[model samples]
Target: MIPLAMLAQFRALHHHLLRLIDGLDDAEYRRQYHPDLSPAGWHLGHCLWVENHWLRAVVLGDDRTTRHDARYYQPQYSPKPERGARLPPRDAQLATVAAGFEANILLLADQDQRLDPTHPLMTDHYLPLFLLQHHSQHLETLRMVMTQRALSRHRHAFHPQARLRATPVAHETVSLEAGDYPIGGAAPKAFDNELAAGNARLEDDTIALRPVSNAEYLGFIESGGYDNPALWDALGRAWLDDHPVEAPDHWRRDGRGWWYGIGLEGPHELEPRAAVHGINLHEARAFARWAGAHLPHEFSWETLARQGRLSLAGQAWEWCDNAFFPYAGFKPFPYLEYSTPWFDGTHYTLRGASRYTPAHTRRPSFRNFHTADKRHIFAGLRLAF
Candidate 1:
């Protein structure tokens, strides 16, 4: 049965998402802020599409709503760069999402108590939870895209005096004894990629209690970390060929100090103690090399997290040392597009969540994977070994 509280939460989340795009103009809503991001309109429609399809179409066999253009909604059919062109007008997209939400709410009234034992929604008991999580993931993406748009629209215009500053704090590394530690797939709501929870035999190692900070990364910048070929791997160097090797996304220099921006917050002076926000795996790896440390493996991260030794939750996603791949006896979920398509060894696994990450979806087992060169996400690194 769908609990009343759960239903209320669902309504609240929908409202929150609506407010996120409440003031976006037509151009801003439809703008593809980056090659990696879809337009805001596309995400709004896609979120509704999944809820409508899974709840009404798949579960109730009641796909009365007209289907969206497959070319715009399907990831494989539409690449990221071309999605803006495929998206409908901003107002039409908003109306479509609103309609889907209303339909989904009505469907929720027929609680699972009436569902047959073998029904798809019943068999996959977490479908509602999954839908909520799916929306949360896309909401994070939308938030990032929106943040990028904000930064681009108001670069260096923010006043330094009006901006707030974060006080510097010292961080410590904690030691864990050698043992077999379990990682991923432990949580009931874990995604398919985190399934087949496996044990990792870890040697005695030390890991940072918190994520690496902007001040720490600045040392890497000053030391010619980008120019030093020894610190960067071949792929990292290759990635730098086309992109600026120095400075992370959202960061800029003004004479002697640095400033960074995110979302609608405008820009602020670089916070020495705050976790660095926008470094990709390659960049994280290079920074680790410069510090004479290494990125923690997923297991090590989980071990620290399980022990409650880890800090800085819901701040920055931490990069793992391992490449993204399926575990032994892995099985794809009903949604085939989630993980199986990305197991081509091109993406590295990242663990944990950022400040903008939704509270309900923050799970230690949640494995986030992206290409090595992608840096727009709120990703940072923690030192291991």
Candidate 2:
């Protein structure tokens, strides 16, 4: 069961996300960083969409309640037929978020006596609890977008890819023994204890020294890698049906040439050796299948990471086939609302640290995971037989 304190943490997170949007205007709200990112106003509204969808609709079993009201607020590109204000003005959206926040606190109060431990919502903190974690995450994206737009004039100077080129990779294959590994973050402050108690584990399964480069990934694409049904699973085929993927995320063709945003330069030429990132697990798994291989499991990846043999802690974070789950004999940390809830599902695991990962965040034992469809983040994958 989640402690009262952890529930409080979730409530606090609600306010924090609300604060990021404390003073948004119509122009600012409509700003779109990328098509994948829901506009700020949409994101703000989605924070409530789940609460209403899950709590009032799913949790309370009030099936008649219309959840599409939340969708109306979704600032997506499918076109809002009822244009102008997609949201219930600013106050209504804010009120929804506020009400959702307060309702979560009430959920926590009765959680000890009336809540179902096995409920899917509780499994990952139910809808109400998950909202806090969910919103906190989007806040980071919204904040970055706001900062970028506010400083649009300086965009040319601050791009990550603009500063670096496709440099040669220094590290080589690193390896670790294979086993089940816990994936994702520790408690807010558990890293200190993880180190102090020697609970964290690092493995060194041989990992590629560099990211799967663009040229190599493109080779997969050119081979009709996306079309080969044999290369995909049931769900993967479904994804391919709706989404025509080529190369990686944020990529497009300009006349005879193809390019992508490497965090700068307005779509520079694609590099061949700099790890094929931005491809989702469906794409990665499909490519692996064509190559007579499959994605590496977390234990396999961790084995590579712990060996300290590869420089992945610097160049990039690598993906593995394993889903993120708690380790054997693992118990919930202070804010039990975090990782445990995601264990039962199809969350994909990744290893090593990215440049964005803090030095202290680096660990062979650390497990990171996301849904197979996610590609907007700093993620890439490695292949193994």
Off by over 4 Å in 2: 1-26, 29-172, 175-206, 262-266, 313-316, 355-360
Best of the candidates, lDDT: 1
Score candidate 1 by TM-score against the native.
0.92
> How well does candidate 2 score on lDDT at residue 226?
77
User: Which lDDT values do the candidates have, in the order given?
Assistant: 0.77, 0.58
Best by TM-score: 1
Error of 1 at 316 (Å): 0.5
* Steric clashes per prediction: 0, 30
Instruction: Give the clash total for candidate 2.
Output: 30
> TM-scores, in order shown?
0.92, 0.55
Tens-digit per-residue lDDT, 1-385, candidate 1: 6667767777877877777776798888888988889888888888887787776667767666536454567678778877777777778877778877876766675654443446755554477778788888888998888878877787454435433243332347899899888876753377888888888788988998888887788778777888898888888888887786577887765544545555555666666777887889889999888777898887778778877788885688889998898987678886787899899989898888988888777877788898888888998889875
